[model samples]
Target: MTHIRGEVLIRRPVEEVFDFVADQRNEPTYNPDMVFSERVSTGPIGVGSRFRAAVGSGRRPVEMRIEYTAFDRPHLIASTTTMAAAEFSGTLTFKSTPAGTVLRWSWQVRPKGALRLMGPVFGPIGSRREQRTWARLRDHLEAAAKPPLRPGPVPTRFRRAATSHPPAA
Candidate 1:
């Protein structure tokens, strides 16, 4: 099996980041390689949450069903696939830092049958692709989550500032 890992600093708090990650369906929104994703399990996300993610390959997208094997709040998540042609397992861990949250993603996979034959050709490529995927996820999450929004009306100060905008010539 070949393993690849990557990390990125996220702007959001650990808990918010953890929640987004815990929900498997959120991957497609960030990862450019993900063509689509859907949660196959019904219920709150936890150690048993399952999802099917289809990633866009060069020829066609491949769908893989994955289930969360472990989950720790604001910390760690480990999952493995239960789908054909998938001999892959992965973990994503988050840690608090002064700058922000450090999110790490790792995967180890062995290509079976026909895919194995191309290992020499695709192994390094896949490693790089996986790293890029994680980087995209980290960047998207951090950028999208900046300055949490509160559900309420605009304050008087904000209203006045908006109404007092410089008069157009």
Candidate 2:
């Protein structure tokens, strides 16, 4: 079994960050390796919710089914994932901080079938990839929190009109 853990601090409220991360549909936005991801089960997010995701690409693409095992609103979430090559479980914990929210993620992966023999070689690569994913997640969350920029400088006419007194009520 291989284990990987990482943490990131996002400049957003705990509820906002937790809700965004808990929704499986948001995976592609941050996880570049996720070719596609979507919820397979209906209804609100909670224990038992399931998601299907295709990671990587080409002939060796990995498809996985993720089932939510634990869901604690604005705090923690845990899930089990099964794929043709391996089985893994992951947990994410959210904590409120003065600056923002701190997100901690961990995963335990166990290779199955013929893949077990290569675990030692793949483990470190997987861990590094996960860390990069966390960095992307941080960038995504922080960028989303920023206000959008104005299209351009205000027109001179509009600027002058604002400074001028109204002609009448």
Candidate 3:
């Protein structure tokens, strides 16, 4: 068993952070190791929502199924993930702060099959990988938060003269 814990401060609203992280499909945007992620269940994303994802692990891509066990909008989310070699269950807590939002994660990982023999070796590696992944999320959110530049009023000199009809043809 490996227990991994980490936190990251994101300069964004609690609701925004919570919603982005709640949707597993967004993982590939920030987590490079996540090759692909897709929602498998129907309806809105919340408790009981399921997802199918493939993540690059070692030499091959490991496929996993994730399911939400608990969901509290703008506050908390918990889920369990099962893969070929391991199982992970975790909770993400979101808290509002003057600076923005604080996201914390706590996960319990259990290795299965032949991988169980390497449990001690994976604890530290998993911790570091998770930390790096969330840090990228912070960068992604902060960068994405910037509003796109809107076109300014056209300069008077550059504006084409407006006419209701063609001038005298």
- TM-scores of the candidates are 0.78, 0.84, 0.85
Evaluate candidate 1 by giving its C-alpha RMSD to the native, one decimal: 5.7
Residue pairs with backbone atoms closer than 3 Å in model 2 (clashes) = none
What are the RMSDs of all candidates, in order?
5.7, 5.2, 5.3
TM-score of 3: 0.85
In model 1, pairs of residues that clash are none
Q: For model 3, how does the per-residue alpha-carbon lDDT over 1-169 read when each residue is reduced to its tens digit?
A: 9899999999999999999999999999999999999999999999999999999978988899999999999999999999988999999999999999999999999999999999998889988999999999999999998999999998776665644347885
Candidate 1 lDDT by residue in tens digits, 37-154: 8988887788898888888876988878889998888799999975456477889999998877888888787778777776665557767776777677778876786778778998
Predicted candidate 2, C-alpha RMSD: 5.2
lDDT of 1 at 26: 85
Worst 10 residues of 3 by lDDT: 157-166
Top-scoring candidate (TM-score): 3
What is the C-alpha lDDT profile of model 2 across 32-115, one tens digit per residue?
A: 889899898988999999999999867776899999999999999999999988898989999999999999988899999999
Q: Which candidate do you rate higher for lDDT, 2 or 3?
A: 3
Steric clashes per prediction:
0, 0, 0
Lowest-sum lDDT 10-residue window in model 1: 117-126
Q: Score each candidate by Cα lDDT.
A: 0.80, 0.90, 0.94
